[model samples]
Target: MILPEQFDQNELFVLTSLLIFYSLLFWLPNRFPLSLIILMMISSATVARLTDHLLSGSKMNLYSIMDLDKYELFDFFTYLLYAPFGYFLVYGYDKFKLQGISVLLYILVWALGATAFGEISLLFGVFKYKEWEASYSFTYYFIMISLMLLVYRFFKRSYKLHKVEIYNR
Candidate 1:
């Protein structure tokens, strides 16, 4: 069977599915500050998308399950799928306040979840790796999770410090 072009049925389904799945986050109460979550979501999504573009599109010229024929509109939408996932990563960590071994396990669980999602995407034609292995995605998720946790910690610390300074004044 021939695959549909960019903006085809499969792409639309994936995009719509992402939106619906992301919307589920609204039903849950957010433990972290809303402002912080939004900030992380925007920054993480933008940075992640750019990183993917640079590595997959430009540097490696890697193949994709989505149409990568010149970074079309649908391909851009697929990147958006990560925004809510990013939010949840920080949200879950902050909500639990995981530390020590707990933190390690938490991150590992999320990384594994991400890897599973990647596999699901591959099955659904959301991604077809070219010169890339699923194991590489697990590694990527681990690194991204680590960086995100560091960023969240730094942001939270800075915000607390700023609050203290303001109160002292």
Candidate 2:
């Protein structure tokens, strides 16, 4: 894991980002069940991978993650960065109980923040644009985040129903 020869700014960026993000997440009080937490973590990483695959594929060639155009070991670690992001996104949605017009404002704020984070990654050499602009991702982030919230509600409701059924039985 300590390959100083191959280690570069991109790798360092991922490591540092992971440390910071996970630390912040761990510091927060538990707001959801452990199973839901696990689900959100895995699903976020999965969504990142799937999105990256589609956008960065040869057909689109929108951008390159980390060093070369191919997916490197560092790229895998980069996806882990999304787990905490997804958690925070939905966490706030749940924690704040955002409703009505406030929900729209919340989504706008987060989409902007994510776009800004993407720009920071650009500065850190974590992403190289071929024909892509960071602005393009704002809409993508907005839609994805909205979907995540919906999924969270569905899962939360389902979990409650499941638990009630088990207890009643």
Candidate 3:
């Protein structure tokens, strides 16, 4: 059984925010195809969550677990908040169709967005940094966002390269 003390304001805020965002996403017409948007959300969330755990929870031990106490249910749920942001990232990238210096600028913008959110999270008691720094997060965001873009590109390319007849489905 879980204790009530485990769930706090930060976790609640994250959950409420995610719920509202998801509700909007479901009730509204999205910029990307429904399936593509869903795929990006899932892919980005999975990778971000996994990497976060490995970096902060295990390898670096940058911050204390969860609510600076233990790794509880609320902590895990908070990570889900990233899924919508991930969708937005992909959506922005796809909409721009950027190239040359524009692509570089776009990636930098997204990384800075991530950093801004990180700062907000810190202010909200979401994270407690130890050895980790903002520069580390910027680098991580740049690499992770770049990888996500590559994955999206590969997904698009594969579909184009292997077009199937309508009857094949």
Best by TM-score: 2
- In candidate 1, which residue pairs clash? 65-128
- The alpha-carbon deviation from the true structure for residue 128 of candidate 3, after best TM-score superposition, in angstroms, is 1.2
User: Per lDDT, what order, best first?
Assistant: 2, 1, 3
Question: Model 1 — TM-score against the truth?
Answer: 0.84
Q: Over the full model, what C-alpha lDDT does candidate 3 score relative to the true structure?
A: 0.72
Compared with the true structure, what per-residue lDDT tens digits does model 1 show for residues 1-169? 3344635556866877677868877876755666776778887778768776766775685656475446566666667777788888877787677899998999899999999987887776777677888788899889889899999888788878877321110
Candidate 1's C-alpha runs over 4 A off are: 1-9, 164-169
1, model 2: CA deviation in Å? 11
Candidate 3's residue-wise lDDT over 1-169, tens digit each? 2333656766766777779877866764466545566677888879877877877776677765346555667666666777877777766676667778988898999999898888777776777788878888899999988988888777666655776211111
C-alpha lDDT score of every prediction, in listed order: 0.74, 0.85, 0.72
Q: Give candidates' CA RMSD values in order.
A: 4.7, 3.7, 4.0
Q: Candidate 2 clashing pairs? A: none
TM-score per candidate = 0.84, 0.91, 0.82
